[model samples]
Target: MIVIDEIYISDEVVEEQFVCDLNKCKGGCCVDGDAGAPLTNEELNEVINGYEKIKHLITAEGRKIVETEGFYHYDQEFGWVTPTISNGMCAYGIVDEKGIVKCAFEQQYYAGELKWKKPISCHLYPIKISKSKNTEQQYVNYEPRDPMCNPGCVNGQKLKVPVYVFLKEAIIRKYGEDFYEVLSQIADQYYASKEAKK
Candidate 1:
């Protein structure tokens, strides 16, 4: 695992899968999401070519999602397209010259340029921020992650002081003390769980 701080979390699981194999896991994200990946303004510009292009592709609900979440996305409840398979392959994934399905973003990077920013929703994958159903404003604990794409992120490695230092300041600005405290506890728990993993 790529531990960012604190004592090392055993790297065995990740070394076997990720130390050198990360790029091979491309196309995993796009294999499913169809509505579109959440994107920031800059990333949107890169992908959709500014206002005119995006104006046509997004739905009305998409506008609301972007306004509140700073990301454009599809609700799973909205349902994915039928047949799941498109031309004997995943709908949104990109095919290589040799016809392998791969991540659309990974393909973007494969070309001459790499678009550095992803939608905030895409950036915070595996680690989700949610509002409780009973009270949309209230925070819910972070959800358990889907292991497929999240396998090597050092979830249980304690954010070392330096790492926490950077994170805490940003969290405080976004949420204040209560949020920060809860988040710190959450981080600890997440790392502890990660450390316990086989």
Candidate 2:
């Protein structure tokens, strides 16, 4: 239950951690990342406003991409496709002073107490809030994974429960009650399991 978040080893981060050669692995997840999850009115407004503030900074090509790409999630003819920031290498990924495309918004947009300018789904990663088609109950699992992800942390550092609780609060609030109910149930099971162990 606790060790589920590392479900996917985004190709870019994977190469960063191992092999030391990330050239082949273009940081796709952070740039484009998830196919957009739902955004409540408040969240949606925040994104809209934020994009507006930065719109001037956006290149002509970037603006074109934005209009076409829509939100991190969007409607498609076949069905729906969530938006992702990385279009392979992302249009916004500018080279750093060190000469590498910055993979994290935090690294670039974070300017002291003003991280709001940098991230939207900051609370959303590591956990995926979704529902199984087979069952109606909503559930939060570690992000849907790929092969590169494994027990990357030998002693389990990155995906620990504390990190989940603290770092992911914004995402939790956005997810709201449907997800809250499911989490409460999982909590009950956790307590029960602990009691049994004792």
Candidate 3:
């Protein structure tokens, strides 16, 4: 782990490779989870307030579920999460003809209908964050979900794209550009040390 201030970062973020192959995984991360995408207090409000805009993009049943049960519900493990459809798909999910699940909010964002570009957690896939048990610190770890992300991992290796590089925008959005810059430097030095030994 690389300790920088209150954040504990996993080495795999800089060492391992990953790039989402949506065609292969069909956006499994969106629909395969136990709960809907993890949401912060702010994100929850954004979803609730922006529901009307996102409504049309989602399935009709999903819209009904969100309307009746509210946008988010309490989860024992994840606290408040976006509500899911009966089959466990996100209420905000829109499956294309190809069966690839996509975020409705993102579709709106790309279409210039919404400003918020989906949730931070959704943006930071493959990189999971948890609060440290000992301290009020955040541990950023690379969580590789095999098979679901196997193609992404293989493609990343082929493309030579590290997790940090793949998730640069999300990391910056969560931790600021200064943190990202420092983290990049740390990654650079770590790789340089390995190269020197080689």
Candidate 4:
């Protein structure tokens, strides 16, 4: 593990390569999960405030679920999470013409309709953040969803893109630019030392 500013980062975060292959995965991460995407307290407010603007972008079924059950709910294990449809798909997920699920807020944000760009948890996918129960130290772990993420993993290896590099924007958004810069530097040194040893 690499410890930076008290955040414990797993080795796989720097060593593994990953870039989303949307065409193949078809956004299965949004649909196959047992619970909806986790949301921070601030993000929960954003969803509540922005729901009206993005409601039209959501599917009828999703809108109905949100209307009846509310935008989000507390999960026993995941804390606060977006509501899911009866099929277990995120209530904010919409199907595109290609049958790919997309975030309603993201679609509206890209179209200049909303300022918020969906939940950070969704943005930083394949990398999950958890706190150590005893110490409360945050851990950054690389955990790509299996089968759904196979194509992305294969694509990343072929392109030689490291997981950190692929998630540059997200890391910066979550931890700040300085954190990303330090991570990049550490990753470089780690790889260089590994190469020398080989």
Which structure among the candidates has the greatest lDDT?
A: 4
TM-score of model 2 (CA atoms) = 0.48
lDDT per residue (tens digit) for residues 101-166 in model 2? 442333424643224533333344444454445655545445423532233322133433332343
Model 4 error, position 63 (Å): 0.5
Question: Across residues 27-86, which tens digit of lDDT does each residue of candidate 4 receive?
Answer: 999998869999998898899988998899887999998999999999989889999988
What's the best-to-worst order under lDDT? 4, 3, 2, 1
Measured against the true structure, the TM-scores of the candidates, in listed sequence, are: 0.36, 0.48, 0.96, 0.96
Per-residue lDDT tens digits of candidate 1, residues 1-198? 223222222232222122111344444544445444444334544544332323333334433444455423334643212112333222224456654455443344455245433233443332233434454342212222345444333333432222333334433543467755654565566667878994
Deviation (Å) of 22 in candidate 3: 0.6
User: Clash pairs of candidate 1?
Assistant: 27-102, 27-103, 156-191
| lDDT of every predicted structure (CA atoms) | 0.38, 0.41, 0.91, 0.92
Error of 3 at 104 (Å): 0.3
Q: What is the lDDT of residue 52 in candidate 4?
A: 93
